[model samples]
Target: MPATPAWPPKSAPRLFVADVLSAGLAVRIEGNPAHYLARVMRVAPGDVVILCDDVTGEWAARVSDVGKRDVVVEIAELLRPREAVPDLWLCPALLKKDRFDLILEKATELGTARIQPLITRRCVADKLNLERARAITTEAAEQCARTALPELNEPVKLDALLAGWPEDRALFFADENGGEPAAQAFAASKGSPAAILTGPEGGFDDAERAAIRAHPQARPITLGPRILRGETAAIAALAAWMAISGDW
Candidate 1:
């Protein structure tokens, strides 16, 4: 006899649904997601589609019908609970649009609990479309099979961020000028709430660096000897921190 087909086959298309999914509930997917399912994936009745609500985690659903403007699915069972994300925030100075977009994507995939965009004097870009940023993060999370979404905050001035800094959280400042080794610093602060602050493409200026250093919670740490671009530094530092403090 042929081997049994896998339940909720690995080839199933996955999606993040807005509604809280439970067993036996029918959900109609509309708008862009509906279009993608109908046109791009060509999902048909009986096809398995993995759904996540960000709250209830992953669910296996079977497409019940396909209409011109919508695709309906019935939630069959809960597959996996939402993932536990580390209490790590990524606070990076804004880079160009394309570069910052990359940071948002990777940060979400890497399990960043939150993302705080900083606007500094040297920042190449100051404005960020919150909707677009969320979209980028959501897409990344879906692609990476993340059950939780990272909180994306509005872009704030460096000074404002410093002023509103939480006391309990340690701020791991990735200072290009130098300080402690990143991995060691992260390991030392393991089990505490932490945020990684990286500079813009132009890097932090003298005054900004001094202000950040003066912050009580800021602990400056160097990434490495070679200078890294703003986006590269953000991702590299987060990856290192994840290896040290996250679910790695």
Candidate 2:
């Protein structure tokens, strides 16, 4: 006989739902997600869709009802439990709107457990739209097939962030002036909760550098001789850390 078609198929549309999902429970999806399924994807009754709750994990669901503004999916089976992200947090200085958005999206994909935007004196943008930011990270998680969403934090001033730094967590400061090698520093902090702190385009001022250096939890590291953009430094540091930390 011919090979049996894979159940639910790999082509099924995936989404992250906010409600808790249980097997055989019908889920009513509305708002943007519902519109995407009913209008964009043209999902109809009996169509397979993958749903992740971020809390309970991922599930396979079949569309039970499709309406103009909403779609109902009946949860079928659990795919996998929520993933355990690395204990690394990304503390990047806020750049321009577009640049910061890029950092948020890429950081989520890179498996950072949390994102703490820093408001340095050199930062181009300080205020962030929490709703929009969460949406970006949510979309990124969906696109990357990530079951767990990284916690997005409000922008905190650099001074306050250092002042309240957790003693158990090491803060790796990417200093343009140079410090320990980035790779070596990451290796030393392996298996411990860590955070990478990068400066803005203008980079941290002498006072800010001194403040960070004096913080008990801060460990300065060098990204190399070449200057890097704010966004580049954040993404590069996160990628390097993930590679060594085995989150890659």
Candidate 3:
């Protein structure tokens, strides 16, 4: 027998929908996606779409009808079950639109339970559109075969985030001048429910650093010797945390 090929070929596209999504899903594709499918992809009646509900996992649906304004697909059987996301939360400072967008997409693939956009004094881009960010993560989850979606918290100032920090969940702040290396610190901590914080272009300010350090949950750790970009730091920290303490 031949090896089974991946469900989605390189040419195929997939999407994530809301929960309890089974057959006969009234897919109302609007905006750019609608245009792309109707005009570019040239999908018509009987065309297929790969879908996941972030609950029941993924499915294969076929287009039942196509209109000048919209398109619809008949939901098929549930293909895969819900993915088990890690208990790790990613608290990365806002970077440029493109960089932050990339971080959100990759973090979703890496199994982050939640994503928090932090506001630091050095943060170049403090304003984040929650709707857009959520959309990005949702799409990412579908593409990466993840059934569960990462929670996106509203933008919070560094102080506010630390002040309301949960007692049991340790906050692992990635510091250049640090307490210990990530691997060593994480190994010693025994996978304590953690949220990894990475700052923006200028990194955390003096007062902000002090406040976070003072928190009971704060565990300062170093990434490496080389100076990394804010975006690089965020994803790197997430990767290390996931390996040491998160879902493999």
Candidate 4:
């Protein structure tokens, strides 16, 4: 028996969006990510890689040309179909760029159905660029070999979020203030669509917390005894739910 080649290969294949990927497919490297893959990682022709368009699932690709200024890869074949993501959404308050970026990447790898960036009163960054966030998650998905990209929604205010929230789906909110243990809440939510809500850096104001708690579908869940950073709380909470009530 021989060792099978890695699904993504160890060559650090990059993703691209172009029609018709086959042997001898030519791809142009642009943007910082492409530059980094070409220059930093030192990818060369004949190196196996991965490519995906938000349209189809991931494909197996290989570098056809190692340009001095740009790197081009040819798509070989379709490796896998679009992945089946969970039916859960992560509604997390906006954190600093790096933290939010990490959350998007990790959440994509963990297979969250959707990511809604919430704008609460205490949120440090009021505005979030949807394009950048999508890119972050897209690259992460491609790297993680995910077939489907998680929907990255525009930033919505906390009040508006609570008012227009879907009533049928259960909402598990982290009450930096106090609430039921996460495991218990998630166990009770088995077989139901749910969303995890985490507050911003400064946490939620009293009125904001009250509003979330007032919702009939809302249930406050605890991370633990100690406090968690806004981003950390969101990721940990969702991971717990995925294990308990989701497809983990």
**Candidate 2: regions farther than 4 A off:** none
Q: Can you give the TM-score per candidate against the true fold?
A: 0.97, 0.97, 0.89, 0.83
- Candidate 2 TM-score to native: 0.97
Give lDDT per model, in order: 0.94, 0.92, 0.82, 0.82
In model 1, which runs have C-alpha deviations exceeding 4 angstroms? none
RMSD of 4: 3.2
Question: RMSD (Cα, Å) of candidate 1?
Answer: 1.0
In candidate 1, the residue pairs with backbone N, CA or C atoms under 3 Å apart (3 or more residues apart, or in different chains) clash, namely none
Clashes of each: 0, 0, 2, 0
Candidate 3 pairs with clashing backbones: 23-75, 24-75
Q: Candidate 4, residues 15-60: lDDT per residue as tens digits?
A: 6464545445666766665677678877777777777765666687
Residue lDDT tens for model 1, 10-87:
988888889999999999999988998999999999999999998989999999999999999999999999998999
Residue 206 error, candidate 4, Å = 1.7
Candidate 3 lDDT over residue span 10-118, tens digit each: 4555777654686666667666666767888888787777777777787777788777877777787667787777788999999989999999998988899999899
- Position 11, candidate 2: lDDT: 85
Q: Between the candidate structures 1 and 4, which one is better when assessed by TM-score? A: 1
Candidate 4 weakest ten by summed lDDT: 16-25
lDDT of 3 at 203: 79
Question: Quick one: ranking by TM-score, best first?
Answer: 2, 1, 3, 4
